[model samples]
Target chain A: MPEPEPIADFYAVVPAGGSGTRLWPVSRAASPKFLHDLTGSGRSLLQATVDRLVPLAGEDGVVLVTGAAHVDAAREQLGLADEALVAEPSPRDSMAAIGLAAAILQERHGDVVIGSFAADQVISGRDGFEQAVREAVVAARAGYVVTVGIAASRPSTAFGYVRSGAGLGVDGAPSALHAVGFTEKPDAATASAYLATGEYRWNAGMFVVRTSVLLDHLARLRPALHDGLRRIAASWDTGADARARVLADTWPGLEKIAIDHAIAEPVAAEGGVAVVPGVFGWDDVGDFNSLAALLPSVDGSGTKILGDTSAVIRVESAGSVLVPASGRTVAVLGLDDVVVVDTPDALLVTTRARAQQVKDIVAALRERGEDDLL
Target chain B: MPEPEPIADFYAVVPAGGSGTRLWPVSRAASPKFLHDLTGSGRSLLQATVDRLVPLAGEDGVVLVTGAAHVDAAREQLGLADEALVAEPSPRDSMAAIGLAAAILQERHGDVVIGSFAADQVISGRDGFEQAVREAVVAARAGYVVTVGIAASRPSTAFGYVRSGAGLGVDGAPSALHAVGFTEKPDAATASAYLATGEYRWNAGMFVVRTSVLLDHLARLRPALHDGLRRIAASWDTGADARARVLADTWPGLEKIAIDHAIAEPVAAEGGVAVVPGVFGWDDVGDFNSLAALLPSVDGSGTKILGDTSAVIRVESAGSVLVPASGRTVAVLGLDDVVVVDTPDALLVTTRARAQQVKDIVAALRERGEDDLL
Candidate 1:
């Protein structure tokens, strides 16, 4: 089969943020989840994210927006030009990161369709992912704020839900539907109910839209945030000194809100949002449990090993996830469905059921002033 | 309270052996359980063993029989004179270790009452322990092999039980009784039944007998083993050169059996064994669960820490045993009764219920040829 051609005038905006606190030692504030090879695929989540997008939006068409601290690391991984790598002075959450990238893409390459995908996510089924993105881009060009909602594989309470309304009836984007609204992570019963109705899909926070349309929506909904982003983008191409000055002056003061809250929710309510069904498998790898789900069982008994398989010696421990990142022997005996993450300086022991509470440990570490460990 | 005087001619024999397979990573063959302070006490189990014995058998009267590899470490910790530190060329089980200590004590200081105490046991209530030893010595002087039977706090199937027959009516040893026989680690129902009998006590393998009496019993019971111990003891006083030569030649060929099988059971059957009630708190710290019980709860909820408290950040985890021996942060979240042993080379994660099965992990490691970790 012939490879799909790169979409013309399309830009991939990778807003890399979130420390992935539940991942703890593996995903730190200095080097978050996006920078690590969570799937043991030899490529980091960020690099893999770019690898998937580069085919859809050519190498030069991809733009990365991440914290300034991670800029060098991101560049080292992707080898993206300085102009293409947009470094945020500090975290202003997803909205600002995505908004800034959208405005910059518009200012540099007028009115292009920019698809904002998170850098820290594990994805599989490359053809399906590319096909979904292609359809989403087509929907975006139709002047709708498009979201590629993942098929509800399970009633997961870990992610928000995007409810699909009527079909968009757009040409070339056959799977696209009008997004009704979005719901925050629901309780088990509510999530199950939503999954039962064939309308809800996991809102992966992927927004594909015309750069002009996103900026226009932002101007009407969040005028202050849009104006700040516009000001920064205008100075982006006026040399490194000017770009730094503008970012330093404006980045920190921008509104700190997720893109879902700022754009997806409000726009969906206005009937301007579209949901494209993503048949591909995807995960944010929220914790060790989610990470375990992404990794194949090294042993037949549902034991998942993220690092060197030989480093782990498991005995009667069914469904145990062991990350022997420290190159030391990790032995799990008679523990079923347990998670043991071993790093050089830190170790984590918990059950797959309690993996969501790992963030509590991070909070405790923070309260204990163990910032270095965090 | 007035301190008890050292019993005349009473020598304390500390047999420090056992790889403590169940407590692997923390207790390797090179560094066994006796060398570690599993109780969170400043002193090691070996040091604490000698400390408790010194009051009964003056500082100079304590003899530590350990593997040759651990001799330097034992000496460094105890500052024992060269004669008091009896280093075995190789392991030949509890019988060889204790019998050698007894035979050497007889060869050097004549027929003194020698008490055999395992170096890896944890004990509390020094007064109660000393009182038990005093009574046991009295019974030992009556020409019987006396054993200190610990007050069975629970129906533990982990330890052997000594069933008492009738009162010995010895002068000073008022509580001493004629031991009927010894039962190996029993089933749960059997242990519960034994505990209800009021005459049964947890046999902690503490034997107090006159060196001459023990040798006589060994001679009558196992003549070849008795002759071999006597031969090794004869050369023990000869210069280091001659001692090494004899040990190299005879140690390998000696019978490898536990003291329980060699003398305790046989002597008890022949009505030469006496049980002195030991009201002192004691534990073998056989596994992580037992070790957890020995350690004081760091949290109100049964969480036990063996190393630096600050290194651990536990959340919603009760009844967990954490040993952060590597000076690294160990975060345990939402795992109840879990055992996480973090060392520099190896890590063990299991549930308290499965702690006894940890030796299986060690065996698996040995199968994998991870000798360094062992």
Candidate 2:
């Protein structure tokens, strides 16, 4: 099996942000989810995301956009060239981060196709991912905003849905379809109905579009944000002093909005969005429950241990998710589908069914002003 | 309320020696359950046990018998005189621990009444407890092996039962009754049936007997153990060197048996054991669930915390038992009746219903050679 060739004139933009409060004690504001190796694969999620993208977008063509606070840690993990990393002065959400990267990629390489992939996602089946990215790139060249819609494996209410209308008869991208619209996370009944229709896929927030197309849409819809991003991108390569001066001036004021709400939803409404079916396995690693699904069961009873198995002792406990990160032994007895996350300064004990409510615990700690634990 | 006078010639014998495996991580072999303040009260179980007995048996009449390893800690907590503390060479079960105390007390004070109270039980209602002890002392003086039979509040399979026969009708002891027999912890249906008979009471392992009377029974039933205990007691007061030499020679060879099997059950068959109703609340603090019942509810949800309440945070969790002894924040979300015991070296997460299975966790850890955690 020969190594696949890199896509022509393509750049991968990884926006590494979000504190991921749902994964408290492990994912903290100081070192968010992207900096941690959630998959137990010996590579941080940011490194893994870049590793998956490097083959599609050549090693030199991949760029990382993260908070200024995280630049040193991100640099240590990814080892990307200084030019390939974009440090935001402050968080302006996905729009400002990805837009700045797209504008900079266009300035560096003439009007290339750029795809925005988050730094905190887990991906498997690289071949299928590459296939979807290649098709989305071809569709992007046809002047449409493209997103790789993940194959919906379950009626999950955790993610928004992208509705595919009809197939786009584009050359070299037969899997591309006209994206009709996007829907926010639906209730269980509504999600089941959407799945039953077979036209809906989980909007994985993967967007591949020509720099000109994305910038054009931004200019038309969000002029202030577009102007702010273009000014930052123009001075981004002209030494650290000029970049810092411009970022410090314009970054904080840029519209803090998710890319899905900024472009995908509006572009799909105007019949300018294309959906490419992604057959690869994908997970946002949203919470402990989602993490448990990705981990290999340690025993016959489906117990999942995220760290050293030797540090955990389970007796009559089945389907438990244990993270013994504190260097202390964790013992779970006669509890099924329980979640026990042990850290040095804090501990969380809940059930897998109530894993989502872990964020409530973080909220409570925050309410009590326990910032050190957060 | 007036303070009660001390019982004449009464000695409180506290035999403190169980590892309490079910309360592991907190109740370690190095620092067993008796050393811990399981209740939110400032005093430890051992200290509390001695406090209750001091009112009934006078300050100077209290004797603490514990393992040699715990002698310093017991001294620090109890402040008992050197002659009053009995340090065992090693664990030889309740029979050796209590019988040795009886023999030593008899050797020091001729034919005195000594009440053997375990050093790990929690008791409420001081008046009721003192009254029961007074009656049991009277019965013991009348040549009966007296045991305080706690009023069975529930059909608990965790404790053995004492069947009371007709009243002893002894002078100055109005509530003394003949203990017909003892039954081991029974099945649920059997326990319920025992409760229905109105004659059964929880055998709280409280034995009040004349030193001569108990020694006589020990000599007739198990002469070798009695002789070994008598030999150790004879040299116990004859300087540290003599005591150590005699203990090393005799302690290892003594029979390792519980007092119930050694004297109580067999003596009851011979119509010698007497039951004194203990209306005071009592618990052995055997496991986390039993400990929960002894604690006041922290919230309307019936949550119980054994350490710093501020160190714990609960959300949508009801009837949970939390022990945040690690000086770390413990957060439990959306789990009912769950048990989370966080210690510095180890953690235990289970449910209240499954609290008994915590011993299984200790066994598993022991099997895995994690003796430090145990």
DockQ of each candidate's interface versus the true one? 0.85, 0.88
**Residue B30 displacement in candidate 2 (angstroms):** 1.2
**CAPRI grade, predicted model 2:** high
Which 10 consecutive residues of model 2 chain A have the lowest summed lDDT? A350-359
TM-score of each: 0.96, 0.98
Which digits, one per residue and each the tens of the lDDT, describe model 1 over residues B133-176? 99999999999999999999999999999999989999999999
Alpha-carbon error at B334 in model 1, in Å? 1.2
Q: Model 2 segments beyond 4 Å from truth? A: none
Docking class of 1: high
